[model samples]
Target: MTDRHASAHWEGDGKTGKGTITTQSSVLDNNPYGFNTRFENEPGTNPEELIAAAHASCFTMALAFQLQEAGLKATALDTKSVVTLVKDGDGFKVTKSALTLTAKIPGIDQAKFDELTGNAKTGCPISKVLNAEITLQATLDQG
Candidate 1:
């Protein structure tokens, strides 16, 4: 397996200070975060947005892989992931993540698509890592 990494550096307090995060793989833009800005113009991308992106991409890829393994070809896969950060008892935490996916797969029935999607949700790396609940709504376009 290939290795990927990212780095973040922060100065001063959590709410007051700023931080710069860099994705070693060039997947994310460099941005800063602080009290004034949740995502800065000079620094890189925010963590929450990154997580959402990762989850979406991973889920899509997993579904495609599963379809291919099952001898089905996916013409298109569109996935949208929403990661919600809510107020917990003391601090903010990711409470839930919902994935909405539309897949156009050739020669695959609704039952097969549903099975593939279910497997993808469980197999996706990001989905497994997240502590919050992950829900997926998948639509398989036959035409």
Candidate 2:
């Protein structure tokens, strides 16, 4: 088994506070985030976007392995995930994660593509860890 870690340091209050996020890999080293970044769309990264990135990457990798196991190869697999956050009576809650996938795989039938993508959507580690609703839309690119 393996474990990954990330850390965040915040100062001040909710509306005016700021924070820096760092990951074990240093991909996001001392990245800034705050109310303006999360709610006001100021230009920095937010938690929801990070979750979406993680979900997209995890699902795509899972699908790649699934295809390999099925003796199929993909020229490209582009995936996008959107995480929705909403107010849940007392606080905020992540309600859903919607994934859109466009793939270029040779010699793959619609039935097989759908089945493999469905499996990946449910079997990905990030998808399994998320408590919110998950949805996927997959498109097979022939050109």
lDDT for model 2, on a 0 to 1 scale?
Answer: 0.98
What CA root-mean-square deviation does each model show from the true structure? 2.6, 0.6
lDDT of each: 0.83, 0.98
Per-residue C-alpha lDDT of model 2 across residues 24-65, encoded as one tens digit per residue: 999999999999999999978899999999999999999999
Model 1 residue-pair collision total: 5
Looking at candidate 2, the ten consecutive residues that score lowest on lDDT are 37-46
Which stretches in model 1 have alpha-carbon errors above 4 Å? 35-44
Clashes of each: 5, 0
- RMSD (Cα, Å) of model 2: 0.6
lDDT, residue 75, candidate 2: 100
Clashing pairs in 2: none
lDDT of 1 by residue, 1-143 (tens): 98889887889997677777777866544666564554343444566777899999999999888988999888899999988877788878987789999888888887777888999999999999999999999988777
Residue 48, model 2: Cα distance from true site in angstroms: 0.4
